[model samples]
Target: MTHVVGEACIGCKYTDCVALCPVECFHEGPNFLVINPDVCIDCGVCVAECPVEAIFDEKDLPEAQREYVELNLRLAQSWPLITGSKEPMPEADAWAEKSSKREYLVEMV
Candidate 1:
């Protein structure tokens, strides 16, 4: 079991979760974060740290966000691991309440 980072993280990219991740399972994309399933211990520590409420347990992912299970796995393979907290995207606040930001997710840096 692993956690998945969903669309709510697309534009926000909040790093609070990173600081609390004991395994450094989070990967950083240009505008998003993904949890590496292979590395995640499924402790669920990152879930609450996310301001956008984007992190979900693999088994608990919303039906609409179910695709994120695979999305997180695929992206984590290419993105760099994030082990420390950092500032969120400049427009994080503006993008926080928006629900359909999947289209804004940047796969590359």
Candidate 2:
């Protein structure tokens, strides 16, 4: 199964996972990153690379975060692919501990 970027990644937008990804499956939004399910190789590399522990295998996703599977897919279609690591959002550290960040997600770049 594909991996999904969950709500914990919304404001943090850490790109460590992107750098480890073998395929150019990650897409960057204004404040987050998503994996393109169609291009993802089902590799678990990105999941361990995520500092916030926001990436999960689709089958292992928590019920509370299940919506992220669709969200990642939808956003990946419109956002630009991210093949390299970039500095995370300015307040990444501050946002990392904050839960329920779905409301802060920015759909556009």
Candidate 3:
């Protein structure tokens, strides 16, 4: 199975995980990042690097965040692939500990 990027990444948009993704499975949106399930190598390298702890193994995804599994898959198809690290959103630190950020997600660049 693949890894999933959940709501914890919505506004944070930290790219720490992107740099370590061996398979280049990461996709970047205006305010979030997603893992392309079809391409992910399940290397688990991205998980520990994610400062916000947003990455999760598919089987271990929290019940409340299960929808993120599909969200990542669908959005990855359109968001540009991100193979390198980039700056986090300006409010990243502030949003890192915030919850229920699903509504703040931006699907476009």
TM-score of each: 0.97, 0.97, 0.97
lDDT of 3 by residue, 1-109 (tens): 9999999998898998988888899999999999999999899999999998999999999999999999999999999999998899998999998999888998877
Residue 79 lDDT in model 1? 91
Candidate 2: tens digits of C-alpha lDDT, residues 1-109: 7999998898898999998888899999999999999999997988988999999999999999998999999999999988898999999999999998888898876
Q: Positional deviation of 36 in candidate 1, in angstroms? A: 0.2
Q: On a 0 to 1 TM-score scale, where does candidate 3 land against the true structure?
A: 0.97
| C-alpha RMSD of each candidate structure in angstroms | 0.7, 0.7, 0.7
Best by lDDT: 3
Which candidate model has the greater lDDT, 2 or 3? 3
Regions more than 4 Å wrong, model 1? none
CA displacement after TM-score superposition, residue 25 of candidate 3 (Å): 0.6
Looking at model 3, report the run of 10 residues with the lowest lDDT sum: 100-109
